[model samples]
Target chain A: MPLQNIKVIAFDADDTLWVNETFFRKAEEDFCALLEGYMPKEEANKLLFDMEIGNLPLYGYGIKPFTLSLIEAAIVVSKGTMPIELVQKLIDIGKKMLEAPVELIDGIEITLKELSKKYRLVMATKGDLLDQERKLIKSGLEKYFHHIEIVSDKTEKHYKKLVKHLDIQENEFLMVGNSLKSDILPVLNIGAHAFHIPFHTTWAHEMIYEEINHPNFKSFTKASDLLQIL
Target chain B: MPLQNIKVIAFDADDTLWVNETFFRKAEEDFCALLEGYMPKEEANKLLFDMEIGNLPLYGYGIKPFTLSLIEAAIVVSKGTMPIELVQKLIDIGKKMLEAPVELIDGIEITLKELSKKYRLVMATKGDLLDQERKLIKSGLEKYFHHIEIVSDKTEKHYKKLVKHLDIQENEFLMVGNSLKSDILPVLNIGAHAFHIPFHTTWAHEMIYEEINHPNFKSFTKASDLLQIL
Candidate 1:
């Protein structure tokens, strides 16, 4: 197998490990509904998305940033006349998302359990470190991974640093995740192997409208399909 | 010296290496001033502190959490009748804090540069990973350390994990920081060496009233004082 030389396997945590975007989607719907009087639901949702993108560099990502954006967008949508209770509701939505239970992706546990036997596994994710660590513990999957690598953003430079930290060559590192933007392209660009397993919903910010055809890249329909090869 | 066995030195980032609490102090002042119309500044500041502590378990520590708490506290202080402009101002305050310049504490650079020659230096900090990394880059202190270890909290369990991750024994790890609660107690409790360097200002939430009398611990008046012993 082309992946036979892989010594360290890193998995992206959010959608790849469990249900994340679904909660965000739900929260967005709730926000749009709350402000439907001021603006159309679709338009309000788009505005909130734009606000999030604009704040990405300053706030990074997580429920807290999203909650802040929701509050700001509400103010803009309502022209600073919306009830202050709406702000509280947005904060509650963000808190609820943080407290949401972990829902493991199908066959992910078995996939991790099987793969952990042959290679060193790590959860390489970009978000709030606290939230990711809490999720890993709640998922009861913490034991399967060597450690979690929490980054502000995943880029080629980060991948190179990860490889160096793990004391392995680029060719010996394999990254498996659902996002082509954060996980796959960076790893592949660094001459490491990357596997893509698409999730049901992709955050618009993480969407890349392009076909990837690389020697070090592989795409699978589901998590368990990896067992067929390495 | 008792620290002769220490092979790795992890420094706390916030008030230890640079000015962090001062920013929070300034933000709290601005927050209280904004709501002075609804409540007295002292009472408003106290209420905001209470709100932050209450949200700690759910929100963890960072500027984003603090910003959310400011907004929530504002809502509570005004009983949900505050102007939307105030909310926007709170958001702006948080953004400015994130973009604030990194002011290196006096003698911190020389201390780190000197320590790096004998021990593996790391920034073992409890904060948002991205924010900490950014500060390290801005402080121009990233070059002196081996790597950065960012955690949500600094409990005994977390310190133990850090020591294990460093591939060293308990005695071989030394922690130096400002807070007795987070940086000192936890590290010493885990059978590692810890040094205390008092900062000019301390966050009320991180305050400890008791005197520590650990054999493996040493206290210093400033950052450069560390160079005298090591």
Candidate 2:
């Protein structure tokens, strides 16, 4: 079950191609510190996670929604007495996150460059379109992708749509990414091959508690290993 | 010419199908009020507009980017001494815009319901994916559209890509929307038929000072008028 017949290799942009979840982790730490007076760091972190999950339907995914959730959590944790100063600080935190430099994962460029020569490469990621497009432009990897899809969510249906738009069969598609929740499971469920390249920091929302074993699934420790796997 | 042989009829979401720019206008006024201590409303509006144009490439479009621009403008206008309250107020303004009710333009439902019977209706809008999707879902008119495209920009290249993806000839496509800059000119430039139904309030960025007249173009005062023309 090697990548023998796959004609399209789609890469997930965030943690798989570049460092993403680490910045979020750092932002969460900073958010908790900013609200330490209201609640302990652990409690504050849990409340923020709850707020993010609760607001997912309303805000979808991205730094903006995360920032909004941070504001809402601060107000709730502080019993609506949260000063405007802390709220502004939270907004600044979000701005800094958006402005952060895109640090590509080790060996991503060589991997993509090499893969592009053989298979059609596509970027499939879900986030704020502006932020994601900015990150892609900054990464300087846009030229390698044949197509880029900034979708609302990565469900089985979305993967099917991507394959249909690419005019490729499920067996001809392969997805690679860092998150089992977003990148691997849904793709595998759609009967497409998926490879998981673990990043050190995974967002709480993207964590999967149970191990998934599937015939179309493979795990690699580093992106460079993908060159040999394919 | 009638809409005979038209294979696709696409509508712009923001001002074409529903009320959108008015909310942005309201947000701007609220933002200026929040920063009234630092600058007059007119001056602040100019500066914010300048910042938005400057940050367009980096932030693209949507309430989130607009919110970021508001924050950046406040910091610059206040010379880094802006109070936290103002920043918080800006964030709230953005949230309210996102939360604003989706009020469809008069006769939009009848037009869509009628046009959808004879033509392939699509939603071609430029905005944040989440915000646009939320608005479509809230509009309760999602079922009328055969396809929905939330794109980064509306340009000749974008329209070409859309027509190609939809598997239709440019001459067989018709675009209907409010903005001449975004909806009309680009579509007409790409050799597609376009109809303009003017909205009462147009954003500065969307305003076209020069008149555009093309053989493939027609003007309507209201959405209902499209029923008779097509």
Candidate 3:
């Protein structure tokens, strides 16, 4: 009954709609292996994570920012002695990630297809505008949504703006995605319904230790499960 | 009478609303100076421009893309001989540019304030989402606009979508900006009014040698000049 008033459903792009974090995880492993000569794999990965968090305020989110942070972290881990070829390699890694195929989450297409008929669906992402737009088009799922909402970050304020832009009230909006920090918590805090259908892998940055228990919140393990309730 | 039906005036950010291209030009000079040992300043500048154009489809527009292109161009110019310190300098240069203060165009605040009273004002740009949002807030010009629209590029298709999103007819939308190619030409092609206020320094990439003469087009030398006719 809580979702009865929902007129718009916004789904987070990255891991929510496609296989994103798995690719990032693979990239991180490759990065750590590349820097193994300078630092241990675990240490180098941690350093890269710290570098990304430090740069987040300025760089926002995307493969490009991640690539930039990788270079910066390599510099620090290698003590400013990284070879030029290695730097070039890091740049290529970012581009390859950008060009990577969008592997749709299992059953996401049918889920979106079913929901589109009854609700105004939107793909919301806090990723690079061009990169996400490319993925949306590549996924062959653009036709399912009315439009895409790309934001720099998904904060409560941003959610409020998104709802206002949709010309709907907070209760009339529903957010479905993988990361609780980005797609669920802030949305739930804003008096809207947030249903979490988490991806198998989440970045350490998006991990939360606490369990979520909110009146406007629901949790599901797979995308297809949404149709059972919504 | 031509402008009578306009309800929303979307102003292009960057050089149109503030001092943007000047900063980029200065950054280019500094970048060339850093690579002077490997390539001539003129050649280095041209190479950087070429690198940017080549990467545009993948990277889109914004300081982040420009920064990434800078690093890529430096690698090619130096031919793998550039020291790690130089790469670090390029990274630092990008951060400094991102952190640079927003300098509003002369008399633009007054123009925006005056125009906001009678029309729905929107700040639209093809810049990074966070960067443009920061500039708008820093310029103290956010209050004058109804909302901000960030797009990957400004083409006729993009303008059409913007007008549709604003829930207005083509003629009811007006675009004002410094780049004739970006803000005026495509806008006119879409049957919307486009007012061009030339910025003193235009990016070589945005330069269009052909003069624009369209029924929906008008050119101005400064931002304040818009008040006279609109």
Candidate 4:
């Protein structure tokens, strides 16, 4: 059956609507390079990931927390001997990430514009508020969204609460995003329709090794592909 | 007359419901001490404040952004001569701030418990999403609030949007907080009632030098005072 009853269509802002994870990947490469004198590239990446996972409860997501984790990893790996200059360089990397231009994924504008005409479009993404708001404004896609929810995490409870707030029945809401862990599974778990548009580069944290098979779930390789599905 | 018609009563989380600004103040003192070798206390504070205001558009608010600003200020003030130990110390300061316990204001529990019986209680505060969520969970006051909004900033437009979301008319909503700039004036400007219970120490950014005179506005010296007014 077609998703004909869906009245609200929400899009994830990061990699789904725009280029995001790629920047993180790039930053990680530079971050690993900065700490090579203290540890191997593989060891540095593992330590940084461990720090990020451990800090999730307190620091949440975004470049700020990532930067902090990098510093912490540096200190731990280098046994507190990491140079001050290197720490300053890490801070600069974070600043550069924050200042990175908002590059919308291909066909996002056309897809959003088309989808907005038929449904109540909303932007649901998790990250630092100012950074996300800045990106939204830069994307110039705010006009298409009826509501924007910058949540801390995308848990099953959070999605349920969001659907309740939007006042739409679960079956009548659809979510589109790049991360199956964050964007797809939670909505699917709630019995809501979800579309996964895989990006070229996915963060290890966002990777889902398990297979997903749900009646309401769909996958697309491109944003424009959503046109045919919806 | 009485605020008997208020259907929804929202409180600002930081400073108003609990001790928040004091932590920031303490952190600022510690931050200044960390950089004392590089610049005078007064000069360091002025430069840090300037960096904070300048970085506001990029970093927004909260300890993460504040921490980043501190690093930037340190680099500029020290002319890149800042020691690695100092940078490490600054990171520690931020971690300490984040790990600080959520200390509720006097009589907040009773006030919220009593008020929750008669009105829909909500938490409306601006800051990092993760930090705010952690504080709310730690506060043990989450059960009292029906909804929690961790917004980017509290502007008149944002409040209007919130009231609309709650499906409450402006006259039937009341906002209580410590900052007149954030919690009081904006609500009053939108034809809503506001209560100001000032904290002992206020951030310079939150200070409102102008006089406020509104029929729907009230001020109190204690949280318990709210019980009598309501």
Which candidate gets the maximum DockQ versus the true structure? 1
Question: What would the per-residue lDDT of candidate 4 be over residues A71-140, giving only the tens digit for each residue?
Answer: 7778887888876777778888888999999998999999999889999999998877778878898999
Q: Compared with the true structure, what per-residue lDDT tens digits does model 2 show for residues A28-129?
A: 999889889989999999999999998787678888788777877887778766655666688778878889999999999999999999999999988876
User: What TM-score does prediction 4 earn?
Assistant: 0.94
lDDT of 1 by residue, A1-230 (tens): 66889999999999999989999999999999999999999999999999999999888989999999999999999999899899999999999999999999999999999999999999999978889989999999999999998888899999999899899999999999999999999899999999999999999999998999999998999999988886
Residue A168 shift from truth in candidate 4, angstroms: 2.6
Listed per prediction, chain B TM-scores read 0.98, 0.97, 0.98, 0.97
Give the alpha carbon lDDT tens digit for every residue of B1-230 in model 4.
64777999999989888898888888788878888888898898899999999988777889988887887788887888876677778877888899999999999999999999888999998878778888889999989998788778899988999898789899999999989999999999999999999999999988879888889999999888999977
Q: How does model 2 score on DockQ?
A: 0.35
* lDDT value, residue B57 of candidate 3: 94
DockQ (CA atoms), all models: 0.87, 0.35, 0.83, 0.61
Q: Candidate 3, DockQ to 2 decimals?
A: 0.83
Which candidate, 1 or 3, would have the higher DockQ against the true structure?
A: 1
Worst 10-residue lDDT window, candidate 3 chain A: A145-154
Winner by TM-score between candidate 2 and candidate 1: 1
Q: Comparing to the true complex, what docking class would candidate 3 get?
A: high
Against the unseen true structure, what C-alpha lDDT does each candidate score? 0.93, 0.86, 0.92, 0.88
- Could you give the fnat of all candidates in order? 0.83, 0.30, 0.72, 0.61
The Cα RMSD of model 3 versus the native structure comes to 0.8
Q: Which stretches of candidate 4 lie over 4 Å from their true place?
A: A77-79, B2-5
